[model samples]
Target: MEGLHHDTIVDGEEDDSPAKKQDSPVEEELVGDVRIEDFSEKQINHSLAPEERVNLYEQMVRIRRFEERSLRSYQQGHIGGFLHLYIGQEAVAVGAVSVMGEDDHVITAYRDHGHALAVGMDMDECMAELYGKKTGCSKGKGGSMHFFAPDKNFWGGHGIVGGQTPLGLGIAYALKFNKKAGSCLCFMGDGATNQGPFYESLNLASLWNLPVVYVIENNGYSMGTAEARHSAGEPLARRGDMFDIDWSVSHGHDMYEVRHTINDALERAHNESRPSVLEIVTYRYRGHSVADPDQTYRSKEEIEEYKKSKDPINLYKEKLIAEGHLTEGSALEIDRLAKEEAEASAEFAQASPLPEPTELMDDIYWETDNPASKTSQGTMFFETP
Candidate 1:
C-alpha cells in the first residue's frame, strides 16, 4: 500500500506546504482505484442446495410481506413513531445472513426489521416491538429503530447515524479477546459513510486486525438526497481504501452473489483475523421513512423500472424456477405462507399488552452490590432519582 499525494485547497487557494506531503500510512495506501467484482455465472450456480434456495426465497418473501403489512398498519394509525420499511432491500440481509454462523454478531442501522427477521428473530416479537407492545423483542422500549436479540447475537437496530460502527468494533474486540472464532457483521447505509465514527471504527479495525465485516447497504439515497448529490464517488466501497482491510461491491438484488461474497469475506475474517468492507448496491422501494414522499427526488418511473429489472424476490424466484429447484406453484404457495405469517404476526402484536407505566424505569441502570447497603452485606443497590 503506497501513499499518494493529495493537494489541499483552502479558500480556493492550494496549500503547497512540504509538511502536507506527509500523509498518514492509511491515506497513502488509499491512492489506487477500487474495482467492484461480479460473480461469474458458474460461481452463482451450485452454490446453494435445493432446500437452501427455497429457504432464501421464503425468507425474502417473508421480509417483503412483513414490511408491507407494517406499512399498512402504520397508515391505519396502529403503529406509532418513525417506520422505516425495508421493502426492496430484502436480498441483501437474507443473503448476507444466510452465510453467517450461529454465533456471529449482527448489527445495523434503523432500517433493521429485515435484518432482525433474517437472523431468525421471532416475527411476532418484531411486530410487537413496532406496535410498542410489552411482548416486543426490546420489551416495547426500543421500538422500530432498536430491535435487539442478544440470544441470537443480533446486537440492535441503532437509531443514530453510524452509531453501530464503533459498537461493532467493541464486539469484535471482545470476540478477539475471548479467542472466539466468530466475527461481527455491522450493516450501515450509504448515508453513514460520511460520519466520523465510520472512518474511526474502520481505522481501528484495520490497525487491530479485528474480525468484523463493515457492510454499507448503498440504496442510492441518504434520505431524499441522491448518492451523486451527497457523495463524491458513487461506489462507497472505495472508502475502505484508507484501511488495511479487504473491500468489494456486490449486487444486493442477487442473493447468490451476496451470499458468496459475504461467505468469502467471513472466511478471511475468521482465518486471518482481518476486517472487510462490503458495499452492497441495493435500493429501497419506500421513502427514507414513512414521512418523506420519495417522489421529490426521484421519479416513480425510476422505481418501477428498478422493480421490473432488479427486484430481488422476483429475480430469485425466476432463478429457482429456471434451476428446477422450485416449481411455480411452490413459489406461489411460499408467497401465500409468507403473507399469512405476516398477518398472524400483526394480529399477535395487536393482542399483546402494552408495557405498564411503572415499567418506564426498568432496565435503565445497572444494580451493583454496595458495601454500604442498609439491608445486608452484598446487597444489591440501584441508584435512583
Candidate 2:
C-alpha cells in the first residue's frame, strides 16, 4: 500500500467525486467519545481473568513501543522504503486478535506491523524484515509490507490496496470446503473500502456464505484524504448491507469494545459460515507513511487532541489501573520492557546478514526449493538472451 501513498488524487473517480461530496456524512466520529464506562463490567470480555486483562494492556503497549522503535530506526536510515507505523491503532489488531480462536486466520494491508506482532510474531524477525536482512521473516525480501507466517495462520502483509480481500475469501472458502469451523479475518484501511476488489470479495463471500470477517480499520483518513472526502456512504460498513452481509460499527480506541465487536462477528462466522463487515472507527497519528507530511492534511491540534483522549494504550492502562488489575509501576515496567525488546530486535536486525544474490532464485520455485518434491520437466528461468 506504500505505492498508494504516492498516488495522484484524481479529481473524479467511481467512489470519489465532487457530486458525491454532498452525500458524505459529517466528520463527527473522529473525536472518539467512547470511554471505558460505556461497556458493562460483565460484558463480552467477562471471561477474561485479571491477568489476561493486564496482558491485553501490555500487548497494546508493546505494539506502541515497537512502532516507535521502528520509526526511530527509519529516521536513522536503518530501514528502507515506506514505513507505515501503527502507532494509534494498536487496539484494533491486538484486541481483535485476542479473541481469535485457534482455527481463526488473519490477513491485512501494508500497515501490518501491529497485526504481525499481535499474532505472536517475534520482534527480531519482524524488525529484520524491515531492515531487509537474511534473518527477516520473508528472508529480507518482503520488507515491512510482507510479513508472513503460515504456521501462525497470519497469511501476509500485502502491499496493494484491497488486494488481500479475495485471498481472505479464498481462505474462508477453504475453511468451509474442509468443513472446518473457522473464519478468516481480513483487514483493510478506510481507503480500501472504495476499491473494486473489496466489493467483489464481499459479493462472493455473501453468495457462498464464506466464513470471512472483513475488518475496515477506518482511521478517519485514507492516506491524506479524510473519510468524508474519500467515501460517499455514511458509514463504509453499510455497503455490506447491499450484499446482505451482516455489518456493524465500533470505536477502536477501547480494547474491550474492539474485542466485543469483533468477537460477535467471529462467532457469526464460526457458527453459521456467514460473512461480516465490521467498521472499526480508529485514528492514525502519523502520516500515511513515515516520509509523508501529516501537517499538510490535518491540524496539529487534531492530532494532539486524539493523543490526549483516545490513545489505546493509555486508555487501557488507565482502565486496568482503575479496576485494580495493574498498578502504575507495573504498567510503566511493562512499557520499559517493551522498549528494550524493540531496541534489542533492532540490534539483532543490524547484525543480520543481507540475502546473497545467488539465493535470489532459490525460494522462487516450490519445486526448486524442494527437489524431492519436483515433478515438472521444463526450464523454469529464461536465458540472458
> Of the candidates shown, which would achieve the greatest lDDT relative to the real structure?
2
Compute the lDDT of residue 76 as modeled in candidate 2: 96
Predictions in order: lDDT: 0.80, 0.84
lDDT of 1 by residue, 259-328 (tens): 8778777877898989998877778889999878977888887678678777889978877897798999
Q: What is the lDDT of candidate 2?
A: 0.84
TM-score of 2: 0.90
Which ranges in model 2 have alpha carbons more than 4 Å from their true place? 1-37, 40-43, 383-385
* Model 2, span 1-385: residue lDDT tens: 2221211121123224222211232122222432233442435677889988988888888888888999999999999999999889999999999999989999999999999999999999999999999999999889998999999999999999999999999999999999999999999999999999999999999999999999999888889998767988566777898998988766688787788778888999999899999877778989899999988778888788778877888888877888899999998899899999999999999999999877778778889889898999888888422
| lDDT for position 370 in model 1 | 36
Clash-forming residue pairs, model 2: 1-159
State which candidate has the highest TM-score.
2
